[model samples]
Target: MKKYYLRAAFIIAVGLFISGCAGKSDLSLNIINGEKLEENQLLTTKNSIYLVNGGDGMKTTYLSVVYGEEIAEGSGLAAVNIANEQLCAYTAPVVLEKLVITEKEALENAKLNQSDYVIYSRVEKWTDPLGINCTVGYYTDEASVVLSLYSTKDEKLLNTTRLSKSSCPFKINNIPVSTGSAEILYEELFANWKNNMFAKVSK
Candidate 1:
């Protein structure tokens, strides 16, 4: 009965685009679409999962609801250090959470469905829509992640994959990406990023 990881930290990094631009998508949607990719792999007993550098979404999936949404891009690591104090109680099979964390923690925890897993996400890109003119800048970012699940019982691989994405949306008609209103757009991109990754896994 030692400390467990129930909390997470979020980091959103932003920097100017050098000059190499890439094509972006135009469609916008809510609840970003996700399609489970073909994972055909099973589980093994020699490995353990680690959710590193990415946001808190992964932690929310397996940890308690109290720590739900506790970590994400730019989250404080100190908060995780503190929450670990109560983490031991959650390590039991009866306390294992869900495949993915929602807004609420299930009143009665259940045994682990799978073996141990790891989630790692990193935001490598952020920028304004407009340039130096102040009328055409926008905020955009790229996130990359890897999820690993090791089975102490199986000694194989289960539900594992490596995912990486650099998401950004520029004004098609020169409308200029707005930083003040970027939250909505940023959320949209993040949602898409998350959905796509999950889609690949679910399949």
Candidate 2:
């Protein structure tokens, strides 16, 4: 549950760009915490799924504070897109397009969809080094999110996992690159979370 505060003076213009042969990312994800039911929570092959927007659309604190709501919403939508793409492995999840601020509403939507389970996510921390010196750009971005799984059958919480990524490094020709937003780090976080959730549910 770490909070990232952006300095008002760090806000910079949007014209900065770096050019280079993009190298493999140096991003590594960490599991901040996770919880699960004592009973096995494995999923069957062809299960109905729903994803409730857990207020990530307008709740990105540092992004909104630094780059305005438009940038924040874009980053938040990137998160949703990641979830949608990755969840297609099982089935194209029924995703709630609008932000749902309350868990009750989220669960109700899942129930209405007749989903076997529902996934909910909240962005916890985000850091964008827009003004940080580009010379030292190895692992400058960071993002964190908490994902919870609920069984719509009984409307009971089944599992929760918090994943974080702060080690994403953009490089070209082996040179580090710094961007104005934390989108890269956020992608890494969501990708890792997807893998983790699949592992847990398949167990």
Candidate 3:
């Protein structure tokens, strides 16, 4: 009788554990604030822009508790790279280079090159919901990035913009049963963000 009671208690404990785990919400990215750049606020072709990768807040495992596995693996860096590429494609007649050196070194380089502006960007959050709806699997990816623009001439912060984007459902239908990758979703999101940022530039 005692053994039977103990077994029942164990089963109840297991059930409770499972329930707790299931009830917990997975960590996801949320945009706090976002703004669009005005024509007067846009960077001009005469200005040079320096790209700096501030890196996401996930170089350590402890952050994983709040950021989850997807963000802790440095996927944010990939998003930064994508944003840099998109910026280069859209912004014409402007000098842009990815900063490979330290912040101080980059600043020195910018001054030497007579750069008008230095843009520093960092990924804040990234989330991918690999969901399925009948015939298609969707990578509903979301991301937030903070962009800071500094005037190299005055060495003062000109503006700070937080950009966030959520990708539409990417259709996946094939004989090989393939789902979309995170890269595809991030590409779409960053491209949209880049276009929106420089919308007034071309005008």
Candidate 4:
């Protein structure tokens, strides 16, 4: 009877832990930084048939979040927004997308197959995940994520920043925090990439 009671209690505790980690994390977005902007911009597309091509007369560059299989939820677009809003402001309301991969991969590959950019930056870290528990009393290890920009143009890498390891037990805190941190890192990384190698090949 005592053993059974202990097992049941442990199971309940585990259940609660799991719920705390993922139950509240409904969406991975809300981190893409372009929410507050003053001047919109023109569409950056070189050749296009889409009517949303230019001059919305707003400051918010309408950027769509890129959902990817290997995506870190809201990480990619969030970062991109941060960069867009800060770098060289425009009045044309540019359209941006968070991309795990762009559709113009073939063109990129053909042009910048030898680009030398490989900038990496760590945005956040947490570990032991929340799935495992031990006698160590909520002991979690250090896990980290890095934001990288591969310049498909000049092959130049920049701003390999590593953020501090976020002390989180699970997704409850880590997901949001990591998502925000990663965005900031990517924004910085891409901004520099623009100055160095971006938009050189695929424009």
What TM-score, over all chains together, does every model reach?
0.29, 0.61, 0.54, 0.27
Best by lDDT: 2
Ranking by TM-score: 2, 3, 1, 4
lDDT of 1 by residue, 1-203 (tens): 12232222111111123222322433332222223434333222232323233223222222324454223433212222222222232222212222343211111111133324433223222222232222322223322233333233444333343333333434334443533222333344444533443323332
Q: Write the per-residue lDDT of candidate 3 for residues 1-203, one digit (tens) a residue.
A: 99999999999998776544331122222333433457676665444567776665332222345765444356556766776677666664334444334556656766887776776666665654443321221233445666666667777665566655544342323122334334565576556545544535544
Candidate 4 on 1-203: residue-level lDDT in tens?
Answer: 99999999999998887666642211121212122111232123232210110110111111212431122344433444554564436212223433344324422442433322222222242222332221122232322333434333544332333322223324544343232232333344445433342233343
Which runs in model 2 stand beyond 4 Å of their true positions? 1-34, 37-40, 57-74, 130-139, 168-181, 199-203
Pairing residues by index, what is the TM-score of model 4? 0.27
Per-residue error for 193 in candidate 1, Å, reads 9.9
Model 4: weakest 10-residue lDDT segment is 49-58
Residue 149, model 4: lDDT of 41
The positional error of residue 72 in candidate 2, measured at the CA in angstroms, is 3.8
- Model 3: how far residue 8 lies from native, Å: 59
